[model samples]
Target: MRLTSAFSILCLSAALGTAFAASPVHTSGHAVTLDLISGQGTANGGLNFNGGFKGSKTFTVPLGSVVTVNFQNMGTLAHSFVIRKGGTVPTDADATDAAFPAAYAPMKVEAGLKTGMTQKVTFKANKAGAYYIVCGVPGHAMGGQYIHLVISKTARTASFN
Candidate 1:
């Protein structure tokens, strides 16, 4: 009985780990996982994130949460997904500055993944403020492919609204 119980516990733990690994947005004590899609629609001339454009959708998470974004490009054109420092529509310099090098997936700033490519990006929400998930391609963000990312000290969980 003891052996069986131990084996069962080990199996359960492994299963739970795998489940969290595959989840789109899974949050535990201090970690958050998200699946971010870029250019998912025709909105804003195909410049959009998660089907929302121009900060229409705001993703909120607790400050200090370890964030992992699994990014996928769904647009007809190549697109790069990146986290900029602010929520404003960026100038050419800001768009390709690669401010958060750890948060841009697939390549460096100004580099892009072709359509239908996927990559993972990880970072920490160390501060509470408004940020942006923008296209690293120059002029793309100004064309309206961006969304708001709010790292909130008061937010108890992760969500978008």
Candidate 2:
């Protein structure tokens, strides 16, 4: 009887452990840093992400994760970070307030940081698709201050039998 009880408890513990492991776990997500630089010369400045200039850069994050962006203003002027998931890409003709699509109107972020300032913004990567991270400082994005953010599908974890 003693041996049987010990075996039962062990089995219960294993079952509980497996159950816990199979459950979806909450995570604090990931972080990436970007620098907002103004024009160095005749070339328009951009947000540097992953060692690439804006409008030509891409950042990847897992879906269902929280993404934190640490933006540093390394320029001589003020700038902001705005994120949009859908709609036409803003152009020089669009105003900063109208740059983002109406569908993503709520997901925008404007840090309004001055030169040599830094700010942090966090958002959930619930959707899997291409997102735009742009500077909403009137002419910044139109001047090539933007990045493409790709939210990839989350990897599935193996479950214990």
Candidate 3:
């Protein structure tokens, strides 16, 4: 009787495992891409807040789809990409107004470049909304080294302009 009970438990566990594995996991369909470049660092190959993007002015990606950003540093200094919720992205308005907090905002995922280094990052767009991507390397965001992203249930294939 004990042997039979053990076998039944094993079967139940296996069935539960299969069911769990079959369930779909929820993810944001949003995707992101960034071109990492120096943002006003040391002119002599040092880490400062002076260098910025040089090649691509803006990057357009699909909404609600998984985005993989391939960033590379084409300058002589190191650079980093810092993404944030819409509220945190730098704006022309008053600093006080931009300080308002919102829930479920995107946070920073650092991607750096060391003068020809490349980094890749992939994320799902779980929410149908818009967010800002920028280089938090001090003055880069203010100098227009960042762009807004719109995420939706259906993916978009046009430029984000």
- Could you arrange the candidates by TM-score from highest to lowest? 1, 2, 3
Where does candidate 1 clash, by residue pair? none
lDDT tens readout by residue for model 1, 45-69: 7888877887898788899999988
Q: What are the candidates' C-alpha RMSDs?
A: 6.1, 11.7, 13.9
lDDT of 3 by residue, 1-161 (tens): 99999979976875585478531112222434433334344433333222323212333445555655555556564445544456454532222222123211113323244566666656555565655555544444555555554555555442323
* Evaluation by lDDT, superior candidate among 1 and 2: 1
The candidate scoring highest on TM-score is 1
Winner of 2 and 3 under lDDT: 2
- How far out, in Å, is residue 141 in model 1? 0.9
**TM-score for each model:** 0.77, 0.56, 0.46
User: In lDDT terms, how accurate is model 3?
Assistant: 0.44
As a whole number from 0 to 100, the lDDT of residue 25 in candidate 2 is 23
TM-score of structure candidate 2:
0.56
Q: Can you tell me which runs of candidate 3 are displaced by over 4 Å?
A: 1-60, 88-111, 158-161
Per-residue error (Å), model 1, residue 101 = 4.5
